[model samples]
Target: MEIILWIGFYFLTFYAFLPALVSRIFGFRVFTKGRSDSGIALTFDDGPDPEYTPKMLDLLKRHGAKATFFVVGENAEKYPEIVARIHEEGHILGIHNYVHHMNWFMRPSTVKRQIDQTSDLIKRITGTRPLYYRPPWGILNVFDYANLGYLQIVLWTSLFGDWRKKIGPDKLYRRMKQKLKPGQVFLLHDCGSTFGADRDAPANTLSALTKILDDGKEKGYRFIGIDEMIAVTEQAKKKNKSRQAAKGSEARGQEERVAERKSSIGPIKKIVVSLWMLWEKLFHVLFKLRPVGDAHFFNYRVRRYSGPPLDLRNDRTLRSGDHIMEIHFENQMLFEMGMKSKTSLQLAIRIIREIEKTLPDLARELAVVPKGDQVKALYGVSMIHRGSEGLGFETFELPKGLFARLTNVYLRFLIRVIHPTGNQRVREHSDTLNPRMLIMERNTLLEWADESRPNRRPNRERPVESSL
Candidate 1:
């Protein structure tokens, strides 16, 4: 019996718990929230209740609000008119399985059947197949990740206990109102027939929802369907990328013109730049680096600090395994700037100016990311040590080891390849060019971000350095 229990434990761990952990913690293969500036998504699940859904729809329509309803196949099949009404009313229809049941207890094939039946039923009623699926209670089993490739798995950003009558209208309304800001996906229910749910719980939800819609509308919030919300977020991302690319092109064009006046990039330097950029691309893919807002010069990835404990300002100590945002310079941009500069000093000053311009943007972006507040520090390693103190970074000598030695070799090679007077610069600064760790604690970064003047240039007296 003990052996059998162990086997079951392992089975549940691999087949159910592991996948849920990955989806919940890492957000792998899931759309939890959006990035809209004013759009809010209201998603309802286990719904199409005869009593509540129509009322909710009426309230939403009166407020000119659109929502997404993840209707159960059984419930939707029973109330096809409600499902049709949802579609005709210009709202999104998504799947919530055939019956309200957790995916953890279902086999991969069973989960597929639950989804297919619901999708086909929705299409039969509404004449449109759902491209989105929200598993019961937003829980996923192992196969749900790859098996549901045809459907986008949606989770929620804000989940009020609206499925319980114990939480009254006032409390639910207050909770919903708190999440009224943009890019929020709210989880609500329009049915209470599922296990452990109060049969009339959606009554309170409907009651609270009216006030939420009114409040949100008054605040200039657009209550959109999940599909529209996702679309808007994607559009925003594409627009940001386009803007950044345009700025990068403008900078590159200006730098190229400057380079033409001084010395054109040699064929060897061009080859090196190409190879270096290719490696940077691969590294970004491997590490899943995200850009710091619209900033063109830096990208970062959250990582566990595996080094020795280091005490920082603000009573913070980053021990081994603490989370940190590992910052990386956009190498190609730096190389382009280097090509434009006649001297290393000029390149260094330009780099400092860029950091001063972009650090606040980075701080703002990080402040919005999930678990961003838990990050211990922003960390990087660089050979350039000057002006770090002025820019609010603490510099530490990298412990002598194989990692440090390899970093030293790689950075030196990068300098030689990217710098115009690479050989001469290396000869002159060899003694002071060792790599050092640069760290900015979370509080200090936020403080600096609050104080940053994006339009201002770097102080000429204290030029900052780049973490190349």
Candidate 2:
């Protein structure tokens, strides 16, 4: 019996007695305060009183001061207009439970209900979720702290024990001044814990509040709400973290991957890249085959890059997100035939003539792709059954014969209108198209070939067999 009694006593002591003891002895943080001692947050609890709250608001307004008010849900519901007024006047509201009790020692379900009810009530009244919450007396045991994040836990740096009448206005003010610091959150009372009290508590608080604000202003202290206080602290912490990261990066002897401002874009290199861009753009315009959203087109336009060679035999691989494009023998021909030339654009022009001779009747289709239709879904792959030994991509062919159309347009424009060249095939070793190399995007040459290899098409919605 004695052993059981001792266990019960110990548990009770830790639950009930420890809250006050911890608050008094250790002053341990239930949550961290603002990073600096340069600001003040004046918070009041147990408010929305018909008698005291209005007076407090008026006094605060007169001094051009704002505060965070933590009020009970029952009191808030009874006087919702007061709650709305508090929010309208630019003061933040926080949860202080539905009823004032030693809730920290209560069961988890009881505490959860208390918090949820209070949060809902405050949110409904003010049309905003209360950002902060404080269990009565800044106390929480094992179960009390569970899911406290439903409304964040906040505790004051200084509580003047203004709830007691004997402390009086004068004594409370003295305690407040003594405990005051730059980042201190001063806790005071606006109304009685239960409903119906003498106006003494609020009156004393008003007197104390004026003195503190006056003193704070003289010391160049900014009075902020709990939200601002938390935000400022978080900002300070992030800045400090960034500084530490910079130092660590410096220690590692590696700077962040910021673009280096080159002194000059070399004369020859700039000219070459510019000409290549012009040639590529014209190729797309003339052919009427713009790449699927950026992809090679975007890379050429803005983020310029050139692969070693092309692999036409690859499957349609995911280039960027969902858009897929054709991988052809153009890059291989460029590297093998045009690589010896100083300018790539000149060699590209030569290759266009050779492609025109290979397929003489090339022209732009002049038809717009149907809206909301995928290219692969709309056009089936046209399998040209020429033997693999002679042709580059034996089974790889774009639907609607796009390549043939592009070649015809190139030949007509270049041969008849502008300049002419010998239509000889630019031959290169098969090793030029490296199977493992990602010709464009993240796909290897072989992967691109596989997708273009053609397979059974996805099942289409056939007019809903019987839409009864």
Candidate 3:
């Protein structure tokens, strides 16, 4: 608990107070300021708000100044007219993120969805893709850097807490004036999330922006946009590229040494790979099985069942000593009873036969109920399969007997030690018919079970981005 608290505290302090430092260290070199002579590039976040954006625009127009608005994608879609007007009025449209959630908390997929969706919407309306992205709350993770590599990341150099309601307009102006430096990027909020505390952000920020613009005009700080900031960043990167070029000769020598080392290890690596292949071949020979059409598919050829035979006639629990049995067969009747249809019973019988022919280990004690059924018991897990177009698999349960306890034990270990496979374990689907059960994770008989074959294909989810 204490460790968690410490981590949480550290995260809050780092992101809240040292965002630029964090970004710099994490390989996300967001522009915290424009060029020293470019004056402060003005930018607004979470806007084009109907109530305050038009008013803000009028103020900017009257002041004869230009600023960038990093508008949310959802809001942009909600009010494309406002987005179109922002583009028409000559303000730079940067993506502030689709939703106003903090960047630190979002997954890579969510971030991608947010940026791509928002950029597409803005581009559709304005015919220009966004070139700049300002992370919400100036907090970013490593994944954000990797994903947002194409766009220039912009962070603020100066912020006067305009979002806090307690900070009055005069104080806000004073704070901005105090931090007002050449090339400083100003952090000011023009809107807040609908899910968050309103705090009258739009109104408060308008007042602060007014004070800054007026004071900035008097102080001769030219209000620029992200383009200037991008120029500065690119210029620096170009210089770094030039410096790195000076080390290219040494880098080539290092690459040559690496190639020589790889050449030395190449023969030994091939020998090891050959040995592994030989060992795999031996295992296949032991099972009298071979890889079928696909390299992944394994099938057995023998049918007489020369492997260890299973005794399935008894439901009695084998006893060891002290009223303690190594394996219990009780309470597992839930599976036998769970088979509601004849098809399910048939599938179970087929799965057991496959196990008997292929993997003869746990098949030793396997059994099916009812002597008239031809098969005494079913072994292995029953995976759910939906009708033909595709199918999905759920968890695999153990069969009956000592191996049932052992299978349960094995599964418990898998659950505890091995990482969960999640939905990736299953594939294929059909929506027209109700789902049915198919046994997965079998003996050498896996290739014989064609229903289980559908689980091998990959499942592509619905496209996240919609048609514009």
Candidate 4:
């Protein structure tokens, strides 16, 4: 029974003591200002003026509004009546520190005394204690011995620059209203920057106030006191903390699920890579077997190449990517072939042809390629013999059979000719050769003992399908 009684007493003591201790240490002003809704908090510093304060108060009253005033302690004592009017009119009174001293230069006790006197003076005049405090010149570090934060620090987002002598109502209004956003605080002065409150600064503030208040009211915004705004902001903070905790848990769960899925898929990627390599090599061999040109056709037109040499057969292998073959001969004959390959085989064939055409005598040495199903995606091809640079890899999704059309066009670009003496100047031989030019050219050295060949019909005019 005694233990239970002790625990209850402890709980009660902590509940009662913690907030006051914290509030006293951190200062109430740090936490207790303004709402975050579509409201503006207007705070005016250094005032309780008999001249401009009354005019400002009357303007606010006409507009049915209230503001916070951080008054100098001495000024409040001088115009106690004006302070009372402000209190009665429902504007919050705040301390701007007695003497507005640069407390950082003063001793600790002097700083305390400055706050004490202003606080006392404000309470004496208004009957209600001032809940807000503003540091002189928006500064706190210079006055280190003077501690503040009696209520929330009310910082303004908009300044009218009314303190400058040159500013007029039009300039002030444009400057202030341009940044008038929801949940902003605006700072102005009713007194002190200039003399007697009837100066340019105070006058400009008064002039700009009416339009600002009217515009805000029409936009469905209500001005909030600093304390109320702080209360709303705290409530929103608590709600956000709760929402973030829930989202964090959901994010954690999703991350775990994704990790598990990736673990399951590790092996499948390896298999696809293996198959693509094998198909690439097979096509590379086919490209080597295909003949390039025939010498018999040169009777009709000069054939630039006698076809890829049989000795270079073993030197050919598939490479990856797109390729272009440019054939240049000492005889001034030129051929250009563009072949795009999605597979290694197509790329190897085009490279081989390019090499053969450019350096027909050295085709065997240049045709060497690696054997295997391990070659990956190729992006480009280059041939040393022709100095031809190929571009736009196999990844460029051109239409099927486009490479075939390119090949035919390249072959036709170069004329066929038989230079028996291998000279640049050739003698005209014949005109018009049959389409069986490849057969005649290949069989030129073969001894055909059986002459039982069937009679050939006239050449058929079959249409070739469009490659692209």
Best by lDDT: 1
Between 3 and 4, whose lDDT is larger?
3
Model 4 residue 231 lDDT?
64
**Tens digits of per-residue lDDT for model 1 on 61-160?**
9989999999999999889999999999999999999999999988999999889888889889978899999999888998887788689999998787
**Least accurate 10 contiguous residues by lDDT in model 1:** 451-460
lDDT of 4 by residue, 316-343 (tens): 3223231213222211111111112323
- Range of the 10 consecutive residues with the lowest summed lDDT in candidate 4: 294-303
Using all chains and alpha carbons, the TM-scores for the candidates as numbered come to 0.56, 0.48, 0.46, 0.46
Identify the runs in model 3 with alpha carbons over 4 angstroms from their true place.
Answer: 1-21, 24-27, 193-199, 232-468
What local lDDT does model 2 show for residue 178?
Answer: 55
Cα RMSD (Å) between model 4 and the true structure?
Answer: 32.5
Model 2 residue runs over 4 Å out of place are 13-29, 193-199, 242-468
Taken over the whole model, the C-alpha lDDT of each candidate is 0.82, 0.55, 0.54, 0.48
Model 2 score (lDDT): 0.55
lDDT for 46 in candidate 3 is: 84
Stretches off by above 4 angstroms in model 4 are: 1-35, 142-146, 149-151, 192-198, 251-468
Q: Is candidate 1 or candidate 2 better by lDDT?
A: 1
